[model samples]
Target: MSQFSLSNDNDDSGRLKIHLNSCYLHVKVTRPYIIITMGDQIYQTSISEYPDGRWNEGFEFSVSYHAQLFDTIQLDVYDSYMILPDRHVGRAEIRLIQLQDMPATFTSFYEVWDKKLSTGASSHAVRKTTMATNVGALQATISYRFLHIGDPQQQQQQLQQHDLDRQPMEDDLIFRKHLQQNRDTADILFHKYEEGSHANMDQLHLGTQGHTESRTTSSSSANTMLGSLGSWFGKGTASTSLGHPTDPTTDDLPTDILNDIDSSLKTYPLLDTLGSWTVSKETNQILRAIGKLLAAFGQGFELSNLQMLSGFAVVERFYQELPREQRTWDVVRDLSEIQVASHLWRYSMASYGWKGLNFIGKGNGYLSDAIRHHSDSKSVMEHLSLPPDDLLAYEFRNSGAFRPSYFVAHDPSTHSIVLSIRGTMVRPKLIAYCNRHSIGALYIVGHSLGAATASLLTIMLLDYMDELQKGQSLPFTLQCFGYAPACCVSLDLAEKYKDHIQSIVFADDVVSKLCYGTMMDLKQMIIAGAEAAQNLGISQFLWTGAAGKEKWKSAFEQVAECRQRCIDSMENPRLYVAGKVYQFWLDPTPKNPTRIVVERTSPKRVSSELILKTSIIMDHLPTNFDIAFRRATESMMTEPREQQDGVLDQEDESRTAEQELKHTSKRGGTDGSPMIDEQYTR
Candidate 1:
């Protein structure tokens, strides 16, 4: 019993047991066996009698408990033929840490890959082909455990102390060493530059001395040399001395010598003034023309503004002819602000993969149809609709790298100008066609990277509102909606623009949580979680059944404690969610898997503590956000406003928004949206 006890094994060494179950192969092989290698040790299994590659054999290997984390086990399957040399069929490598992080008894299928061929075949191509062809799979069970050779209680205490001491020591040593290396390199570079500059100056002085000697016969030449020397020593002396005869002038010096003297004097001042320099409008136009010509020569063609305008006209005419019902002013007024914003947010996401006028050539107003179809699929543009003709202008730009795309559309029914910026990906082009241009309330919408852009643009407009409306009779009113925007501004700026901007963050969305402080906290939390799992032996029970859930609960509690410590130690200024935030998440209770909830929370209330949930990333997707919005809207309609608002207000006052979310999904729910309710069951 003592020997079987994982925490009290007689020997300090760790043992790994592997069971060879079976292999499914594409090609038939006779009497197949497997060769297993781990670190310096190797073992071979006996050949199976069945031709289908079944062994049903078990083997054990001893490993140093401390060193086992870095070790990997390699399995090479071979066919033993009487006449031919044993042929290698396939191989698979399994890292020991992977098995250690799983249940005590884990069974899974691993892909088997053929040895690289000598005939210049790409390994990646071969792997892809093998996967595509359903080549082979090896099914096996792996078990691993390690116990310290000491009293259980004392060993646990020591292990905790060691972990606490070792991690920081290692990280600090590495970081300090890297920082020192950088400082040394920078010092070397600076010294080298300084020495080189001095040498160049000395050479210039020598050249001037020689030139002065050669031109000593003329008084004018001497005066010119004196003038050049004075310019180098004093500011603005050359310009002042040019008008006087007694004073030295620059006219007599050779062009090359005079230019060199002028450049040397200008270099330092240029460095100081570089930040203030701006290109004139004419220069920008010239550069734009040059860029256009270069692009035409490189791509063999260019998209002309005339062609874009024609495509826009066709799309506009097609939409105008369609028998679509226009929204009445009363209906538009009845829609909630968030509902309208969510509709515009769809436009933000649709901007990605949008080719603008390029799709018009497909015929029958393909571009307009595509946008309408996308909006219908996402269930957007329903309440206050904007027709294709209302699309005043659209621009997409990609200068060697992907830049965000934007479209300007007018909703005459609501009397609002919509600017939707798309997230990152692909190239962008521009098109514009407007029958009647009229100013209206400005609404800006964007998602992900585009969201950050929209937020900044809103701030700029707010700051320069006076300048923009200098001569205008009516003041401009603008609102911005950012969906899953990155942390783009300071807490001050976010608070300052709260009235005009709103950021919609989905449950456990990682993008919105990103900031210097949050990232640091996340890093610390990961390290702490890993160490806690190992110390508490929680990893061994992972995926085992009901007992695993109990272990995971304990593990999360420990990680939460560690995460709190990390938060207390953080000193960096955390960038909060911009403006008033509306967060959507699923009801955490098991009985309400499809019920989505919304909370209107402040930026400061959003948790900086990173939660390790699968939804952290998936929740950031636009599709997920769309589903969340739809469900949330439905939930809002069904539930009384007062009741729902009371529940949200109570939840906000009781605990953090994220903490409540994490507590509800403590049973390993992957996503916080109803779209993945099936995942909760499994």
Candidate 2:
């Protein structure tokens, strides 16, 4: 029998089998799982808890004789964590043919490999450490026993376990490679941004060849949250910088925070049972109606104060009006502390997309200078040609672990991508209140820009916990649902925290597709900008009239030129809708008036054609999405079958004359196309 042995070597060890061609075998870690390919066979391990130091007992698995002929083995060790990206700890290569003949048993075959940061670097420099040292090492011992082809009993046993072995199927291989590439690309881009920012900071410090000084100078203590000598990961006193990893600080966490987070991570299959039938029809109808009110509430945020509920009062009244048995959810908080920092830009001279708002730090709110150090994001206002007043007030005072990207704003320069200044002020108060009084899960919901802000805050909180807890997973559970959200994240960040985000999209929602200009062709970008300018009205400005008209005209021209320049430079901005997406579509055919469909889609599948018939403004509103959502959910009650194509075959449609006509070869689907639409062309 051929005996192939694999072992952890250490708590973080992994093995890779090389082919005769000298190509290094590949293996990747996705949190609790590890995927490895040996010879032509791929093996996947069962999900297990993160390992502690040294489980030295070697592992045994079946391998073919041809695999044994392969002469090399590469072992890579990684430190996998939930919140942070996995770190490569160590790697080693062993030439098995040189050790001894494969058939012989060898116990003395061993090697110690030092952990490395990069391929050429010999020093074991950790993320924060400047000097190299023996930070970590791995000692591996491997043995192989070759078996004869005539060992029928051994072959039979191996055959029995074949089903348990997870060979990397075609789809899995493609998807895993894609995810890896996306991650790598994101890392490269972020590092580039960091490098560029550092260069700019140096120039600013040097006064541009001694010709200029900094724009402003303040005490270093003014930016207290910004890194100083004592910041985490910064060089400073070890006692203050490195807290005990086992116990997180209690100052920032709720007493039951750990328990809450742990419980939320556990599976809840009951959620799968939710449908119109699960609750009273009346209750579903009430919720459907409330969806419209909620949309109105979100839209009103730009014009109204946080204290005003707008349509929410109507929603609360409707909930109270529901029959006792039909009340599915008890009204907990009508408008909790879910404050929205409204964003507005001058789309045209005649009118703004949304009206004027106060600029932060000038009789409005405070904006920090910390984000300014990340030079890549400095062009936010210039790219859009937006006035300073248009900038959101949110500022992260501390050095962030993550580089800013599409999640907050369009430009990759120094911009606040997280909470608005108002949100920055209100968030802590809300979080503190939740920790003190939260009896159950914290539910956050937002629409449009509010959705983007909500998503940002959720991650921000997680990072905060990661710091206080020293990598311990937070205890309490929090969930966010964003409706009609614009593109606000890179694919890597999306995949990194896929479990925590969900978005609702209406058919062809224009708002959801906003940030792709950086990814789209220049023609598309120009068209988008023109459309925004036209629809929002460039003449809305007071200076557009005869008084100061010449100056305003020149300013508008410059804005257009700057916009085109920005688009030219943005070759392939990292942007995408992160996490699960629920897409809704309305039936286009007249005969199927009531037919609406909702399909669960990945970020890659979101398309602009779904709502192609509606105006851009109408396509993006939550009010329209709510109507379609209700209709789709109602249709699900009678029709439960999914079509060969993705669209659900609703019972009402299946029972109709239109369905019969569409099923025939002569007349199938609109424009004689297939019933289901084409996938988004990424």
Q: What does candidate 1's lDDT look like per residue over 226-265, in tens digits?
A: 5434323322222232232210121223334344333322
lDDT of candidate 2 over 1-682, digit per residue (tens): 1223433222211122221101111333333333232222233333334343333333333333333333234444555677887665444445333443442333342232343332122211121253344333333344444444445544444445343234436534544454345334312111111221212221111111321112434542334324322232322222223222211222234334333333223222453246233543333334443443333223211222321232222222222222222111211121111111112111110011011111211111122322343322233343345443332221211222121122122112222222211122122323322333232234344566555655666665565442223222345545556667777776666666657766666655666765533323222222322322332233433224564455434434433453345444543243556566666554422344345555556665452211222244565643354345444544555443442133323435433434433443245432232222221100
User: How do all models score by TM-score?
Assistant: 0.41, 0.28
RMSD versus native structure for model 1:
26.3
How much is the lDDT of residue 488 in candidate 2? 74
Q: Name the weakest run of 10 consecutive residues (lDDT summed) in model 2.
A: 346-355
lDDT of 1: 0.50
Task: Assess the local accuracy of residue 93 in candidate 2 as a C-alpha lDDT between 0 and 100.
Answer: 43
